[model samples]
Target: MLSSLAAGFGLGLSLIVAIGAQNLFVLRQGVRREHVLSVVAVCAVSDAVLIALGVSGIGAVVTAVPWLLDVVRWAGAAFLVGYGMLAARRALRPTGAALHVETEAPPAERGGRTMVATTTRTAAVLTCLALTWLNPHVYLDTVFLLGSVAATHGAERGVFGVGAAAASLVWFAALGYGARFLGRWLDSPGAWRVLDGVIALVMWGLAFSLVLPVFTG
Candidate 1:
């Protein structure tokens, strides 16, 4: 049991530690300190649910329906491409910090113009959901691959799944909360531009990943 648990935890961390679109989005939100908790919660919970489903043998059912995977692949690619374009636009026009949370000051102290960030709490959460759920690779990795591994554990699959879920919780919590420490360096618009550019690249890369295999195969 302990060996399977350790194996699950290690594998889960290895799979999720990649520099992907979802991780980039979480890091950006963490740096901005906007809806970090909600974003982290959504990511961790979504992973947990998927891992549970995989361990429960539902992955077999999902893979049995190849058409559903096709739908998810196309939708996920479209969403990623759209998001990547939006991020690229932001990068091209680098702006100052978007102050979503403002302090109430006197009219004289405060400028008449609202210096709000383009992203809202609702939008941030929706984006988080899309990034988590709309990625077909996520299902392939978390559900199908992990499920197959868990099945090898026989009766210990439940414990293995729990360990994997714990890894997700730990990783997201660390990433989402730890990103604020990078604020000192990203204070300038130039830094933000670079970050946004990288995010755009990550998003487009994920989109291409979804599309490439279909054409290649």
Candidate 2:
């Protein structure tokens, strides 16, 4: 059990450490103090669902459908590339105020009289789901990849899978909440620009790493 747990935790941590759109979204939300933990919670829960599905023999179904993997590969690659472009564009844009006070929009102009601030919460949830689900790489990693390794342990695979899920819950919570403490620094336009620029570079680099092998092959 202990060994299985260790394997699971290590597997989970390794994947979560990588910089991706989801982490970038979480980082920005943390800085904004906008339902940050909720974002983290959704990500963790989504991962847990996928991990559970993988552990419960759904991996065989995924493995059987090579087309599914291919579709995911292409979609994930495209999404990563697109997100990288957007990040680079944002980085090049002039820095703006860190926080903007909410303004009341005129009734007809508001489109159904919805508060902009309320809409941000919905956007956050949708973005979290899109980040988690749209990236076929995530399915490959959490399901196909981890699933294969966990299978080696036979009956102990369940224990291992649980450990990995726990890691996701803990890591994202820590990353999302712990990062908020840096909000003071992030409030500075120069600091935000530098941090976001670094993030953009890292995101683009990861995207290249994902798609480069296809051309090289």
Off by over 4 Å in 2: 94-96, 100-119
Give one digit per residue, the lDDT tens place, for model 1 in 113-203: 4444567889998999998899998998899888889999999998899889888889998999898778678766787888889888888
Candidate 1 C-alpha error for residue 42, in Å: 0.2
Which lDDT value does model 2 have at 29?
Answer: 75
The local distance difference test score of model 2 is 0.75
TM-score of every model?
0.90, 0.79
lDDT of each: 0.85, 0.75
Clashes per candidate, residues 3 or more apart or on different chains: 0, 0
> How does candidate 2 fare on TM-score?
0.79
User: How big is the positional error of residue 173 in model 2, measured in Å on the Cα after superposition?
Assistant: 0.1
- What is the Cα-based TM-score of model 1? 0.90
Winner by lDDT = 1
User: Highest TM-score: which candidate?
Assistant: 1
